[model samples]
Target: MKAGTNLEKILESGKFAVTAEAGPPKGTSAAVIQRKAEMLRHCCDAVNITDNQTAIVRMSSLAGCVIARQAGVEPVMQMVVRDRNRLALQADILGAIALGVGNFLCLSGDHQKFGNHPQAKGVFDIDSIQLIQMMKQMRDEKKFLNGDEISGDVPMYIGAAANPFADPFEYRVKRLAKKVKAGVDFIQTQAVYDVPRFARYMKMACDMGLDKKVHVLAGVIPIRSLGMARYMRDYVSGVTVPDEIITRLEKAEKAKEEGVKIILDIIEQLKEIPGVHGIHIMAVGWEDIVQEMVEKAGLMPRPVL
Candidate 1:
């Protein structure tokens, strides 16, 4: 098999790219991970293995990426810098690259207080932007942190996250622009329930002429129930649920069916937005519904490269 970077190709082609995340199991069972990867293999351009997502300890992101790679699926190794210092971050990136994982998503990670280990110390040794710069330096300049020249480069297609719905939306766009300027190859935004609001953000990016410079994948998470909708609206920072959507969920006879319908509607609207490079589905625990949503959205599985 030829070595290929699907995420890189998708960005280069300027087409909408589709990515899905697969959470690792708490135990050592590869069955769950493999099943999730296999289910999304034909639908997603790449599978992102989240690193201790939500600060909850689970299987290692690196291990999950290796399994996905062995299963003939492209893996996006997510690196959270919160739990690890610069040394660990660099070491993990090198290890993942050595294991045939070329795509990465840099994150500052969830706070330790949000996890089971609330007493654990938090380490924000390097922010996501600095991490991206570091990776670029390692890959392009073949230089290490200590100013030592490395023999070989760690070829990687780097990605970062943005939350347009966060407080003071203008600041979010500005922050994302900084990440792009720092050499982030691609970005996956927070779940955007408000299409009009997201369109405004896209317009801002276009006005700044940053839209053409990097690939932006709008994140979408399907709402399973009215209760879930309420939770998201109340708790999830940077996520907004429209009153109409909530009412629709409240009136629906079946919440799951309604949730799928809502996501389908979102995809329909999102597809027409200019500067939208792709959609990233965060169907947390609802991976089985991804194919239906993808087909409903009329997206085909185009190889990234």
Candidate 2:
């Protein structure tokens, strides 16, 4: 049992795991994180604290994890390659472990051009796969990236992201295979609005036996309005919002209710997919809806691991 985190245990115990995202506030208030943690504590097995998601600076994910842990919710802290070099990355990994953060989601973060500080330079010293390999080495081999010996256990459950809806669809599964080979313990994919395309990606992954190698959690975002749906369809890279869904939203009197129904339906379909181990709800700023979504999707009463 790697890391022995509640998330890892829930997956290992063969129960369908549910995870949700909680982005830290732009300011330095720990109270905001505590409130978000309280909201998500019972709705999911673990909560993901994002690391400067979209390249926008926020309270550190490590600090957010510590706050979430204090608030009685397990946190999966995100580590992005765009902001820190290997040395800094290693330092933070050690710090996070010492602070009792047991789960990690490695990412090659969005470009700085997309964030609030567009002029900021990105520090992509290592990509996500290298970060995964480095963490695996630290945890399993008790050694640093340069082959230095580690003095203590670096226990962690490592995770990475996948985008089945990305271009050159055939390469998507192959990329996932690479991450699995690089020692990713779990994966949370890009928001899945086009279920058939994602299903095909999963089918290809299952055919290659990748599912046995790592846990795959389908990502879902509940759209709140027609504008949100269109934006996701047109602007969000690696996310495909189907035209039918857009039309449905356009015709609906209550777009929010329709959006909830769409996610509930997606959850049902995701549960039947052979390779999917669970779902990761990523309702970025609209965290208040997560509990209701989980309950409506029948994912409540998360396992006591």
Candidate 3:
């Protein structure tokens, strides 16, 4: 198959596009990573390789993306500027593009204090917005951050993160609008459990004109157990699980089955939302469940554009 950036095509097609994330292991072994990527390749438009996800050390995102690409899977190279300066970020982008990873997700990343390396320093060298601006400069102006002209520009399908369920939910939409104004091609939101609230937020986005300007991929993370549900409720910021879901999970005879059913319900409702561009399923370790959700939701294969 001819390699192409499905993310760009997804945006242009004006239809929903599905994407999923795969976190590379901490060690050098690519066996688990490759297996997961291959499993999700046919189910999603592209697979995102998380970079040092949650500030925990992991295989390099670029290397993982390259391995996925070699396996006939389109890769989204995640670039977290939280630990690197502008120079390092720029260099990694160029290298990834050369290695055939055309999609990029810009993140500020989690604070190091939350990770195992509590003593390690955090570098917010540039906030996510600034990083997006820098990427625009490199792509549109063909100039380095130091003002030197580059031989060529890097082509990337730019993506950014959003949390619609964050506290003071109204403010999250406003922030997302700012990201869209800052030239974000797409917005993959934080995990969503409250469809009603998410629907309202989608309306807000449409009202702000963001719906027309940028694609929005609703994030979904399946809750495997009651512990997982509670962790999200109490610990994970920007994720809201209703009492109804908790009740269902608590009463379930089989936790995984209940979790998958809940995700299917979420996806079904999301498919009816007008401004929803697609779903980005974050299965975490349950990557295998993605196909079941996609199949259950009746999301067809990537429609030719």
Say which candidate scores most in TM-score.
Answer: 2
lDDT of 3: 0.86
Q: Write the per-residue lDDT of candidate 2 for residues 224-305, one digit (tens) a residue.
A: 8889999989898878898999988888999999989988999999999998999999988888999999998888888896
lDDT string for model 1 (1-305, tens) is: 11248877776766678889899888898888899988888888898998988999999999999998887678998999888998898888888888999999999988888988999898998898999999888887888776678676678898999988988877878998999989888899999888899999998988888888888899999788899999999988779988989999989999889988988889888878888889999988888888778877888755645
Clashes of 2: 0
- Each candidate structure's TM-score, on Cα atoms with residue i matched to residue i, is 0.96, 0.99, 0.96
Each candidate: how many clashes? 1, 0, 0
Better of 2 and 3 by lDDT: 2
Model 3 misplaced regions, further than 4 Å: 1-4
TM-score of 1: 0.96
- Worst 10-residue stretch by lDDT in candidate 3? 1-10
- Candidate models: Cα lDDT each: 0.86, 0.94, 0.86
The TM-score ranking, best first, is 2, 1, 3
Higher-scoring candidate on lDDT, 1 or 3: 1
lDDT, candidate 3, 41-132, per-residue tens: 88888888999988899999999999999887888888887789998999998899889888889998988877778888788888998887
| C-alpha positional error of residue 266 in candidate 2 after TM-score superposition, expressed in Å | 0.7
- Give the Å error, residue 287, model 1: 0.8
